[model samples]
Target chain A: MTLRRRFVLVHILPIVLIGLVLFAPKARPGLRPCGALLAAAGVIELLFLAALARRKRAVEPATAPCDTVTLVWALLTGWELATSVLHLAHPVLVPAPENVFDTFREQPLVLLRNIASSLELLAIGFSIGLALAVLLGLFAGWIPRLRAFAYPIANVMAPIPAVVISPYLVSLMPSFRSASALVIVLGVFWPTFLGTINRVTSIEPQILDSARMLQPDNRTMIFSILLPYVLPGVISGLKVSMTTSLLMLNFAELMGATSGMGYYVQNSITYANYAHAVAGIIVIGVVVTVLNALITKFQKFAIRWH
Target chain B: MNRIECAHVTYSYEAHSRRETVLHDLSFTAADGEFLCIVGQSGCGKTTLLRLLAGLAFPNGGAVRVGGAPVTGPGTDRAIVFQNYTLFPWMSARKNVMFGIAQARKGLSKAETAALADEYLEKVDMLRAADKYPYQLSGGMRQRVALARSLAMDTGILLLDEPFGALDARIRGELQRLLETLCTGEKQKKTVIFVTHDIHEAVFLADRVLYMADGRIVRELPVDLPRPRADLCCADADRLCAARRELLGWFDRTETEVQV
Candidate 1:
């Protein structure tokens, strides 16, 4: 078969098999929701396939996305068969895909509220942590005495996981939100600070010479020459830093928070609402993926010279 | 006057509890508007001497003086183009040139500095790639931008440390001609101190050439070749050829000394 024919076969076989299972005679009453959910999913996949075929010329043939789409279809088909048709596993522990997906339609407002709360905390904590790190890192890196004093301290403190101190921070701070933000700041600050110091110290000697020949003052030297020289390294490290900070924030939220994506998941598991918990996990994945994409875009725009 | 005087300057690099002297009591002077080249084998301290002249480093003993003033540190009075990585990779060609102009001629508006950058970049035939970053450009193009930046600074003293040394032969010749024209073509010629290992380059571009070896000046030869000395078809071809041959002999003698 041609490559295009193979793509169509791979995509269509899974959809047809899934459709047969969805419209088959009902083996149990709760299976109705699963069938409805699978039917809707099949329609969505058809739409997606149409779109993909339209844009297929833009993408290289036989790349990751093609295989990825096929894999996703296979996963969904297997999941539907196990939960609805065979009833092979523990029912409550592995909730049917329909019920898991239906949590979105059933509790849209609740999910949105939790997501908004989580993102708000992430924005505040990330901004404060990154700004302080860059500012202090630049100063500590540039000055000899400051670097000598802080470098050893950062080496000692940065290795200690921020999550380890969250319980104490919660008790010490006036509010849980403040405690969470503090945890994230501490998590992000040390690594970024250390990286900045190393980068500033290791700037290419000839570049330093070129900047020095311009006869700039201390302020100009730190802000203009040193900052830009070290920016590509800093921006490259941002994705990792962002991921760690989010992890820290979520861990803090799990301790005793009233609302957040992490709190939502923890709360659901407490009440044995597996469907809602699964939905929450998927939401977190989507949020992180979107955030990573945004960071990649910002990196490209900021360091076009690189 | 734009004369530069190095009064018995001494320099050394201290690495891991050991001091290795690079320039030992070196002394030289270049009159105003002189195009001087310092040529020697690698590690013979030609670059160290240029760095001292550019005020990028300090002498352990004595001083480097420009126009009767002792050099303390790098100043806007002198602009240097290093062999490689001199252009800030973070900035575009135009921005790099503007940076130099802004430093040397303070109080100019943004428009004025930008215009000055354009003029110099145009002179070096790099105006078409003004917005290109150093990494995006070829080695020869980057050196052209570096030359543009130094010239745009409009300083009395220009210090070049093998500015064209990393380029291919054709591009090196092209830049050599550009440097010669820029140094001698202007009415108020700038004093230039160029350092290179290429003897032919020294003979072609220098009004006077200093041959350095083992941290000392081995010889100084004055080239009385005619203007626009791009080729050997001139009436002074024999003189130019004789000067080149004499420099080559010094290199051969140094190689024999090392072998012995």
Candidate 2:
């Protein structure tokens, strides 16, 4: 469909959401006061779509805004129909949108603290994991013996999911924090390390010859030439690594951690508060979106040559 | 003493578990301040010979020497330019040049490097595009930066492997003129070993042209044409015609005559 038609189709979302606010029956008792929240969500979604439609064309693809928002609207409408309006969903398992949105208003601190905790672990874990991979991968790739050793090792280790071993790692580590961080590290390290080593080995002969003609010493060759050459590959692979590690971090938190987005959901589920758990899921989605946006910007800056 | 010498150099590489020889016992020498061009058909090992000079590849047997000393490995004394991919894509044209200078000459401050980069960039008429990355620049523009980077290194010898081969006719002509001007217009002339498959280009640029075939020098011709080949290309018709005819004779395609 044309961008106009797709954008016009997006009006269904606010309509469905506003209909819930205005006409959703008091069919069930103990449902929260959800009029303001549902109305604000509908207005905000409309304003967001409007802003997206007006953004400069070069910033993103034209149909992305329309296609994605339409999908989100479709899902949300289906969800509201099943739980809030139709009253068909199980109350304890699938909370109404009214109850889910109310969880944000009731206890904002709990969610914020969990998000902060997740971000902290992600920052520390990702940096250590990626940095160590590139560092070791460089030497391992450049040296013959190390490359032979690393290539096979990485191949063997990379296919084994880090989640499969996280429970054991958690039990072995001294604390939950280290265990969770290790899980994130294990998730991120192998593929990136393998990628880095492969890129280093397969540098174009012409480029390599040009660099060799410069007669850089070993230090200059490795740090100055080889490192920069492999960097774009590493940066480009960063998104996949990031998403997976974040998944591992959350999974690790689900086991033994007291705080994190995963912990918030797990705790809410333990207490039978499906509303808070659903809110936590939405928060995780937001975090992933924001992180992806950041990595894209960094990719532009770091690999301009490509 | 020869400025550059390759004494019976042989080179081969293993591809798919098969060793293929590219150059076989090839031997040549170039004098100081001489412009020597090796002309041949594709896959005749012209680039391989040039790489041997640049010390990017070592001969399985025999040796390559520059300034009476054996070439053990690549040195700052000999800078090189390939047809393409010589300039690092991540760096801007200016930074690429700066990097060359930094590698060849140690302890130059960042400002000094920048100044030297701009100097060479201007010499190649690429100063405007100095801040642009290789991807942003056209094929010819990238060659210009590659040339600038090599020149900025201040190497005594320059090894070019069909540096203009990838460019179109117009840009190729422009760069040929630029390269000739840079070589002839400067004092303290550099010994250049250029490898190309273009007979006309070889005649225009070189004092001596070597026609290579079957992984060896098959024939040689000396060009007696005057300076500034761009003007000579139009003016000195007789000598230029005679020289290209001689090169064509070497290539065994006498019917294919090259115009000045």
Candidate 3:
């Protein structure tokens, strides 16, 4: 199809979705209105289309983004039809899109505050975990005596899943918040520690040879040569480490804590407010996507080498 | 006194439960301020000898010495360039050179280190690409940066193990001339040991060329050509041509023997 035609397809599909949500007659009794959800979806799609239009001249192969948006809109229309118009599904189990998204229009501050709290914990835990791993890994990797001592210990500890033992830790620790943070730390530390050691040991032979020829002192070798050499590997592994830590954090929060995204979801489930729980799940997805994008941008700036 | 020495040096590699000797009783020396190139076929232990000189590897059976002292380990007295990965991939060209200068001359201010780095980069015509990381550069450009780094160090001994082995012919020739000027132009000449398989390159760069075969230096040829001899200018010279032919003859004979 022609370029204009493809864009028209993207522009037209969302309108069908909006029309269904705004005007579809409800067969289900006492279903919530679609105003908040429709408004939110409209604004987001508008921003995305604006970006697409602005970059039209240099738009990517013209299939992936446009088709994806069309597909999303088509799915939204199907969901609206199935829930509010036909009422074919179980009314309580499968909530109307209107009620789920209304949770956003109603109590955004509670969600935001919970997100902020979770992020703070993640940051504290992740930073401490990564810093300790890299520092200890460097010393251990460079000195054979330390390597011998630390390797066995790391091997044993690195295998245990923080999530599996997190419930016990939650009860054992004085506070739930501390237990949650500890879970994130334990989740991030081991893989990064082992990864750092592997990177140091497996540095390119020629690069190692050149560094040796320079005759770096012990401190310089660790901080200067070995650190930068392993930094790219560490940064590249950040996504996996971050994802793992976030899993541990949410799992711990789901089990015990009171105010994180995971808690928001679990509490909503306890109160039979599945709509709010679904909204909380959506928030968690958005946060993870944004964090991953930020990490990718940071990786580009940090690692200038191959 | 000899600037570098290797006496009865032997190196072995144990792999897959087999002990393989790489260099067997190798012995050679480069005189102070002389450029010595060891030309050999692959697997001839030429690079192992260079590493021994650089103190990157210890001789299993014999001693390797530099400046009349038995080499203990890597020291600030030597700088080296390898076939690949001489510059750290994470560092820019200027930083790599600066890092080398820092390791060799400890007390230089950061500004002084940077200035020295730029000077060496300029010598290799890589000043424009000083900020580029090694991955951004072509193989030849990377080699120029590597050369700049080792030269910037200004150590007493310089070791190069097939430093230009991966470059195209034209770039290789340009670097060859650049290397010649950099080594000889300095008032305090560094004792250079360049290992290569290229006979013409050895003839072009070295004051003396050592030919190695199967882990031993079998012949030494002295090039009597004039200093800073133009490329192809010394090609027609009788002595250089004879040395080139003799080196070529050795490699050809070895290839035939291996095939047989």
lDDT values for all models: 0.86, 0.86, 0.86
**Better by TM-score, candidate 3 or 1:** 3
**lDDT score for residue A98 of model 1:** 78
Per residue, candidate 3 scores C-alpha lDDT tens digits across B128-240 of: 99999898999999999998888888787778899999889999998998888888765958798999999989998989999999998888998877767664463547677
- Candidate 3 lDDT tens digits, A3-99: 7888886778678778777776788875776778888787768866765766656646667667777777877778888988888878877788889
Give the interface RMSD of each candidate.
Answer: 0.8, 0.8, 1.0
Candidate 1 per-residue lDDT over residues A1-306, each given as its tens digit: 566776776778576656756575544346425544655576657755765666656566654556666777777777766776667757888876778888877788999999898888888888888778877888888899999999999899889988899889988999999998898888888888888889888888899898889898889888888898778888889899888887887788888899999899899999998878998898898789889989999999999998
Tens digits of per-residue lDDT for model 2 on B1-260? 33998898888899999999888888888998899999988888888888778777789988899999998888889989998799888788998999999989889999999998999999998999988989999999999999999989988898899999989999999999888888755594789888998888988899999888878887888887788877765557678888888777766652243221
- lDDT string, candidate 2, A1-306, tens digits: 666776677787768667876686746556888853675476558757686868797876666666666776677778778877888889789887788888878888988999999999999889998999998899898889989988999999989999999999989999998988888888888888898899999998899899999987878878888999999899989998899988998998898899999999999999998888989998899899889989999999888778
TM-score of 1: 0.95
Which residue runs does candidate 2 get wrong by more than 4 Å? A1-9, A43-47, A54-64, B14-19, B233-235, B253-260
Which of the predicted structures, 2 or 3, would earn the higher lDDT when compared with the native? Answer: 3
Q: How far in Å is the alpha carbon of A34 misplaced in model 1?
A: 4.4
lDDT of model 2 at position A201: 92
Q: Candidate 2: lDDT of B119?
A: 94
Stretches off by above 4 angstroms in model 3 are: A50-59, B231-236
RMSD of each: 2.3, 3.3, 2.0
Candidate with the larger DockQ of 2 and 3: 3
- As a whole number from 0 to 100, the lDDT of residue A163 in candidate 3 is 94
